[model samples]
Target: MGQAMAGAYLDRGYAVTLWNRTASRADALVAHGAVLAPSAAAALEAGELVVLSLTDYAAVYAVLEPAAGALKGRTIVNLSSDTPEKTRAGAEWFAGHGAVQLTGGVTVSPAGVGQEESVILYSGPRAVFDRHRAALDVLAGVADHRGEDPGLAALLYQINMGIFWTAMLSYWQAIALAEANGLSATDILPFATDTSDSLAGFFTFYAGRIDAGDHTGDVDRLAMGAASVDHVLHTMADAGVDTTLPATVAALFERGMAAGYGADSFSRVMELIRAS
Candidate 1:
């Protein structure tokens, strides 16, 4: 991702200074007119706007702390992946060194780096964001400032990632179920995609239900839902597949029944889970 970002600036006619833990990866960029830094400190010394694309927030901290003095009066844009707490912590660390800091979550891979479609989030001082907007745009080309929280970008990224992971897991399970019934995944994909889209629409409805604390079941009762869960667990167990997931769901339903919510909604499980 770092190399990709650096390539964007080079293409945009900005002088690029590149460095990495493994110097070999940067060899190609140096050949493309990017200046090679002998050390992390030297990397920041080369530019007023120092950008970091690291493994995580911790890695960013490790690299930047040793170059603290080198960052005096400089602006550091951290595009490393991390939790909101970590992003806030990282920003504070940089601020203590008298350096302006911005933390963001890059939402695209290497191929999207220089494209106008790529999205990068900025969360820090609006003034600092406005100052370096031009340089940042060279990489993302579509960066948005997410207020002064310095953590909203990371928080939003995690929420986005949650949607991805859950959907991916559900899709994999659907694929496995289809294959189990002697149907090819290719044959099921188009309709499965449409089904997933319909199911995803429930998130908004559920969000309203959650906010209103109204998990009343009208059509989808808990015990009625448990019938499907039982079928799933039995089928998975019978097919020698991993039964952990369906088993867990079955357990939740059993708990809900014991709580006398068998006639309530499936989402009522949240009440028990949140109970102290």
Candidate 2:
């Protein structure tokens, strides 16, 4: 991602300084007129706006802590992944070093960088973001400033990843089941895509009701949902495929039923999740 971001900037005619724990990683960029900084401090001193695409907060500290002396007067755009609390703490750490930290969450992969549809969520002082908005937009077409709180970007990123991984794993489970039934993933592609696409409508329809705490069964009852989930579990079991995913889902619906929400909308399961 760092390489991609730097490449985007270079393509836009911006001078880029490259640095990495492994110096060889910067070779390509260095060949493209980008200066190779000898150390983290040199890199920090090379640019006023320092974009970091590290593994996490710990890696950020590992790289920056020793180079703390050079951080003053720099704006650190941290695109590392970590918990919201850790992100906030990182902002404070940078502030203590006389540097400003702008937290960011890239919603797209390296290949998507610089694409118009690509998004990067940012959170920090709005003034600072505005000051560097153009340069940041070069890395991602949609530089979404989430809020003043430095943690908001990280929080939203984590939420997005949670949903992404869960949905992807569910799709994988379906693929496994299909294969067990002598079907190829290609055969199920259309149906799976349709099911996945339909989730947008479900989310839109349920958002208002969920926010209002209205779990009336007018749309779908927990009892019916539970039965449906059971069928999925049993089907996976009969196919001799892994039932872990469906089993966990069925358990959640069962909990909703046990909580006396059997007559309520299946969306009431949100309550059980929240309580957990």
- What is the C-alpha local distance difference test score of each model? 0.85, 0.95
Best by lDDT: 2
Question: lDDT by residue for model 2 over 175-218, one digit each (tens)?
Answer: 99999989999999999999999999999999999999999999
lDDT, candidate 1, 172-232, per-residue tens: 7767777787888898999888987897688877888878888798857899888888998
Q: Worst 10-residue stretch by lDDT in candidate 2? A: 267-276
Highest TM-score, which number? 2
Off by over 4 Å in 2: none
Candidate 1 local lDDT, residue 244 = 66
